[model samples]
Target: MSEISILKDFQKRQMLFMELYKKAFPAVARYISRKGGNYEEAKDIFQDALVIYYEKLISKSFSPINNEKAYILGIAKHLWIRKLGSNVINDTIESAESEAVFAEEHLRTDKLIYLLETAGKKCMDILRAFYYEKASITEIAQQFGYSGTRSATVQKYKCIEKIRETVKEKSLAYEDFIE
Candidate 1:
């Protein structure tokens, strides 16, 4: 195909993907909630499944052998099951179907964390100070010995932007957890 055709096709596929997500999201949410999971858990699982789907597509390792909905639902199912098996989640409310979704999401979260950590020490420190420590820009600047608070804030934003770009370039989604 020509470049323009490929681009158009890609856009079409993305739109289709979004439609599938819209349709599947409610079912996935109900499945999780019915199995004792909360709305938050459902959202987390769905987002992670989408990330996995994105990664697979970008890597060209995904096959359209099945419908997109089924493919994503399958990934979510696998995620839920792994979560149950790991004991991170109690199995009391878990159904066989729900387990797979939780498990796959758990794995995806782990993978995203790993990727964030591997971004580099500076990026990690900036993220931790801004996010985990909840420090003010001035305080962070003083601690890190930057020129001033403004510089510190700018640097922090830049670092996060870098991380975001890096994650995207690698076919990963960093926005959901990054802040």
Candidate 2:
């Protein structure tokens, strides 16, 4: 894509996101609040769901849907359930309960890593180079053949966003994985 087209696409996505935030956030917020989640948690889950929804919208595999708001809310509901489980949310849980939560989250992380490796090997390599190898931006740019540090930085952020979309897709793909 040309720079101009990329800019236009970004603008379009920004408008769509703003519209979704206005039309769908209130319903999702209320649902999360009723389920014992706070404002920040609701916001986080809603954003995650929105990213997933957007990915599905752009993909050719997505079928026609009547209600975009409902779809986004459904995704948010699943994310919340996966994060906190189906039972009641409690602030003062025992050590065992905390450990269980930790283990579940760890498993999710492992799954995400596996998916990244299989589905986005190049992105995984870029991320590992920047993060795990402690490579400098200039080094990354030279290795990846990016124009410069600025380009490398932008690519790094793009890879992160791609991973986010992948993770969201996985959460939706396996009913037992989340919820």
Per-model C-alpha lDDT, please?
Answer: 0.60, 0.64
The candidate that wins on lDDT is: 2
Model 1, range 22-89, lDDT digits (tens) per residue? Answer: 54555565556555676677767877877787666655554544445556665665576676665354
Error of 2 at 60 (Å): 1.1
Give the worst 10-residue stretch by lDDT in candidate 2.
Answer: 91-100
Q: Estimate the lDDT of model 1.
A: 0.60
Please provide, for model 2 over 40-77, each residue's C-alpha lDDT reduced to its tens digit, 9 standing for 90 to 100: 78778987888788667766677866656666777777
**Estimated TM-score per prediction?**
0.41, 0.45
How big is the positional error of residue 47 in model 2, measured in Å on the Cα after superposition? 0.5
Deviation in Å, model 2, residue 25 alpha carbon: 0.5
